[model samples]
Each structure stands twice: as C-alpha cells, then as structure tokens.
Target: MGSVLGDLLPLAVGVAISPIPIIGAILMLLGKHARTTSIGFAIGWLGGIVIATTIFVLVGGAFGDSDSTVGAWIKLVLGVLLLAEGIREWRARGGEHSTPKWMAAIDEMKPLTALGLGFALAAINPKNLMMCIAAGVTIGAAALSAGSNIVLVIVFALLAATTVVIPVVAYQIAAQRLRDPLDRLKVWLEANNKTVMATLILVIGIVLIGKGISGLA
Candidate 1:
C-alpha cells in the first residue's frame, strides 16, 4: 500500500508539473475568467478520472479479471467520448458569439454558475476521462482487489486535486494582487477574449486527439 501510494504521488506530481507554466499564464492573464476556467478544467479532470477509474477498479477487479478484454471496449468508449468533447470544445474556440460554451454565460449566470461551469468542462472532456481509465487499470491490475483498494483510489484523487489546484490558487492570488494595474487589463481580456479561448481550445483539442489515438494503439 505504501508503495502504491508512493507511485501515485509521482504521477500526480507529473500532471501538475505539465500545465503549471501555460495554464498558470492563462490564469494570470485572463484573471477571473481564468479562475472559473481552471476550476472547470480541474472539475472535469477529477470527475471523469475518479468516477471512471472507480467504476473499473471496483467492478472490474471484483467481478472479473482486471486484464480482461473488456478494457478495450472501455478504452474505445472513452476515446469516442473524448473525440466528441474535443470537437465540442473546438467549436467553442472563438468568442462567445461563435459558441455558447466559450465561458461562463455572463448574462445567464446565477450563484451556482461557477460550479456548474466547472462540472460541465470536466465532464465533457474525453482525454481526462481516458486518462483516469488508464490510471484505474494500472492500479487495479497491480494492486489489491478493487474492494480493498477503493480508499487508495480516493486518496490518489485527493493528491491529484492538490497537484492541479495548487497552481490555480497561486494564479488566482497573483491575479488578485494585480487588480490595480490589471483592472484595465480586464478590458483587454474582454476585447481579446476570442484569442484566449481559441488557444485553450486548440491546445486541449490537440491533447485529446493525441491521447485518443494512443488509446487506439
């Protein structure tokens, strides 16, 4: 169990390390929008990974072999889901005029809009979902039975959240600190929102496509 926990920490660290620079920049530049968007990404990443991984780790390991052919079907379904997500996000690349999913609907947003936005972004992401499946498969195949290992999976998820959320918190703090000078910057972000949204969508799409293809391999 200690060894498994050790392995999980490093993977979480690796994922956190990947987007700290780019995503961090986006947060700092985009300000409040970045706060909401990053939260969305984390929600999507955690929700998809944890739930999907839980399903496999628990059910697959208990009822059948972890190495069963069912994994291919799982991967295939995950791939398709991610592909659709990539396309959806891609379509939302431009400004709000181009797509409704670009950012929080400023006009329609209520108190819980931020939370809803977070769930939607995370849930719609296919690549993150597939990644979770891969992680679950790895854990299930090597570790104790799913019934016994459920807590470990949950713990790994907490660690994963910590990894992703740290940078977001840092970015938000920095953004808040810059509020004076960046108040004007918000106007710029609003005017240039299309550029910011497009870039994120493109990067996300490329990542998903690559991962989906790897799953096919």
Candidate 2:
C-alpha cells in the first residue's frame, strides 16, 4: 500500500498543481459568496476525482486480465493522449495570449454552478482525466484489498483537492491579508499556465509510456 501511494503521489500532485482549477478556486474565494461557493466547489471537485477514479478502478477490475495486460494497454493509450495534449498546449502558448475566458464567469457563479464547473474541470479536463486513469490503472493492477483500495482512492482525491481547499480556508481565517497575495498568485498562474501544464503533462506522458512498455515486456 505504501508503494502504491508512493507511485501515485506525482500524479496526485499533478492534479493539485493544476493552475486553472486553483486559479478558479482562488477567484471564487474572492467573490461575495466566498465561503459557501468555494466550499461547494471543493466538495464537487473532490467528489469528481473520487467518483471518476473509482469507476475506472472498478471497470478495470471487472474486465482486466489477470496478467495486467489491460492496465498496461490503458496506460499506453492515455499516455498518447497526454502527449498529444501537451503538444497542443505547447503550440498554443506561442499564439495570442489572454486569460482563459472562463475566469471571467467565476464571480457571477452561484454555488450550484460552481459545483458543476468544479466537477466538469476535474472529471472531464484531458490532463486531469489522464492522471486519474493512470492512478486508477496503477491501483487496479496492484490487486490490493478492497478496503485498502478505497482508502487510497479517498486519500488521492483529498490530496488532489488540497490546492482548492487551502485558499478557501485561508480566506476564511484572514480574508483581508490574503486578498492581495491570492490575487497576485492568480495573475501569475494565468500568465504561465500553458508552459507549466505542457511541461508537466509531457513529462508524465513519457513516464507513463515507459511504464506501460516495461509492464508489457
């Protein structure tokens, strides 16, 4: 179990350092309904990760071969997907630069809307989906006890959502002092988002590809 969690840590951190979601949460914290809406978003974000990863884990368990071939193949396909997305983002970084349009909508969002957006970003975003798939396959391939697997999934989800939760808590504690720092952080994240994501995704993709090929051999 320690080995499994160790292996999953980088991917979990990948999700944690996701600039867009972190920036989005920060923006929500700056809004009028900061506490209520940010809490909703955090819960939805955590639930999205847990639910998506759990589904993949279960599906993999049901259909995966005893030899772990299915897990290896899934990793191969997801790796290729990540590599392609990394290349796309890398190319886009050179073009006309602007803040993501969605950031503009954050202030106007209600708690329910924020919840749905959080779920969509965590569950459907290509980078996050790939990470979840990799984590799910890693855990499923290990054939750990059901109880251990559930705990690991929950832990992974919580770790991934930490970036979102922390800012909300900080704002609740010292909303005045945090406002400036959080705003500056949001600006920097928006500015360098592409380069950061592209680099991380490319590295993870290459690693996953190597792991997949090694497993097959």
Task: Give candidate 1's whole-model lDDT.
Answer: 0.49
Per-residue lDDT value at 195 in model 2: 88
- The 0-to-1 C-alpha lDDT of every candidate, in the order given, reads 0.49, 0.84
Question: Which window of 10 residues has the lowest lDDT sum in candidate 2?
Answer: 58-67
State the weakest 10-residue window (summed lDDT) of model 1. 16-25
- Candidate 2 lands at a TM-score of 0.94
The C-alpha stretches of model 2 lying farther than 4 A from their native spots are 63-65, 97-101
lDDT of 2: 0.84
Judged by lDDT, which candidate is best?
2
* lDDT per residue (tens digit) for residues 132-155 in model 2: 988887887788889988998988
lDDT of 1 at 101: 41
